[model samples]
Target chain A: MGASLLVLMIPILYRIIMGPTGFDRILGVNVIGTKTAVILVIIGTLFDRVDMFVDFAIAYALLNFVGAIVVSRYFNRTVPLQEMEKPKPRRRAKV
Target chain B: MKRTAFILVLLIGLLLAWAARDFPAWGDPHSPASSSAVSSHFIANTGVDTEVPNMVTAVLADYRGFDTMFETVVVFIAGLAVFSILRGGPNRRTRDREFVVDFEPDLIVTNTVRLIVPVIQIFALYVLAHGHVSPGGGFQGGVAMGASFILIALSWDLKTALARFPIERCFTVAALGIVIYAGIGLLSMFLGGEFLDYAHLAKVFPVSPEMARYHAMLGVEIGVGFTVTAIMFALYAGLSTDGRMRDGL
Candidate 1:
């Protein structure tokens, strides 16, 4: 069950690299990260070694989170060139 | 191109499945995992090490507590990373609009959530307390508690829901939990048991060695539960708020 999910990674990575739109690439990366986390858990089960792999899975889950956040933060908004020229606001005088 | 890639992946999957033909069946009684050194440690020590009944919990919170402490830390770091990456700066505008509770919230869900929140909280504590004797432990309970927050989020608007439990305090608590765990470990060293040794606690209490270990395990489980719950909630907050905007979580 887990291996099949990992196999999907190849295609996802391919899309992330070749997709024409930034949105597609971001979606692909997020999907890949989610799958990576599940795969890590399965691999931990596969080897029957709980010590390091479970920790690695937990860590990888976090990494996937961080990756998703960083990617999202990157494309959240694009500042228009005109906005850069706005004058700074003056502080209000204290009563 | 899609077809080509699909076919490639299919072929690879087939090859991998064929190779797995010789692999041991899942949960096989004779599998090395069931018989290995690590499993042996749990099976052997569980009976005498602590009075707790759950072997897996014992392993997670007791014998291998050092690893568990770091695991909580990992969760904390993940929360901080998410908060730092996506949260608006302090000077940036905060969401001012009140999160109005929907009037026609699903009747079953609204009532169920209201009723179940307390039950779930009790269940989490049960899992934490019985970790030594049961299958569920700090991590499982922590996630369960986190799910309660998610339930709250789904019931109400994010702003109103989050106001009840601020993310910043959650992060701080998570960090503090780990610091407390480490402090105990340092205290253990002073008592002349290895770092994180609970034997000293027993000595201080004039209790049996076994009881000391049990007490120590409980302390660590508390930390694990705190950190894991806080971090999981933070991650859920981050993902739900901004995944669609910037990247998919």
Candidate 2:
């Protein structure tokens, strides 16, 4: 199960790096981190090292929040290209 | 590209299931999952330490209360994510877009779904309340509650479905639930027996120490149920509505 999840993670990582949209990449990373935390805890249970991994899961969960929030804030604050005053009326009027 | 992704996910999901073939069968009383060292620890300690009717609940709400507290936090995060995603658009009241499900629901099916929603919700509450003496716990009960909303959404229009409960209020309840859980933990820590030890609650409840701990643990479990149910319901609400709030909801 872990090995297959590891395989799936590769493309998700690729998308995080290659996605054009900032939020899309952030979403990919956030999901990947969530999966990683669950996988780590599951592995910990399987290996009888749950105590250590539970703490790691807690820390990772917090980190996932920080990373997602930072990315979301960045995207939220990003200036629109159209705000530079280049004119495109059909799109501008649509907005 | 969609087909490839679908097939990949299907293949991986099946492979993972196949890998778990050697795991103990579900609900086997004598399986290693039931008889494991941790389970034995609970069995041995619960009688004298917590006096809880259900050993599993004792483990969840007291012995491993810290984890349960954080689980509530996770539910809070999920709720916040759904709320933020749903409300993130430029306009608060954008027009709802139509998306069709492939299957057509008959009148009988739709009516049945509507009728079952309340019954399922009642059952979820039962599960949450009786967790200390039963197989179901907060997570199971929360999923049940969420499933009730899913049924309502499928049978009714988005507006009608969401009218049953406001999503924003659910988000608030979810956050508040986690805060309450954490507050209890902090309270226990201040009383000085570790993060979630229920000794102080025992003193306040005026019961036998073990029984008092059990009661306190049950309170935490209820808190977990509230957060989890709210968060999951919020997710279902978002998924049912699409990217915007429905009109007249």
Query: Interface RMSD (C-alpha) of each candidate?
Result: 12.1, 15.0
**lDDT per model vs. reference:** 0.69, 0.69
Which residue runs of candidate 1 sit more than 4 Å off their true CA positions? A1-95, B25-29, B88-109, B243-249
Query: Which ranges in model 2 have alpha carbons more than 4 Å from their true place?
Result: A1-95, B1-39, B86-107, B190-192, B247-249
Give the TM-score of chain B in candidate 1: 0.82
TM-score of chain A of 2: 0.68
Model 2 TM-score relative to the real fold: 0.57
Clashing pairs in 2: none
Question: Candidate 2 chain A: worst 10 consecutive residues by lDDT?
Answer: A73-82
Query: Which ten residues in a row are the worst by lDDT in model 2 chain B?
Result: B96-105
Per-candidate RMSD, Å: 12.6, 14.9
- Winning model by DockQ: 1
Model 2 docking grade: incorrect
| Cα lDDT tens digits for candidate 2, B181-227 | 77787877787667777877655556876776877776786777778
Give a tens-digit lDDT track for model 2, residues A45-67: 88797864664565455334434
Quote the B-chain TM-score, candidate 2. Answer: 0.74
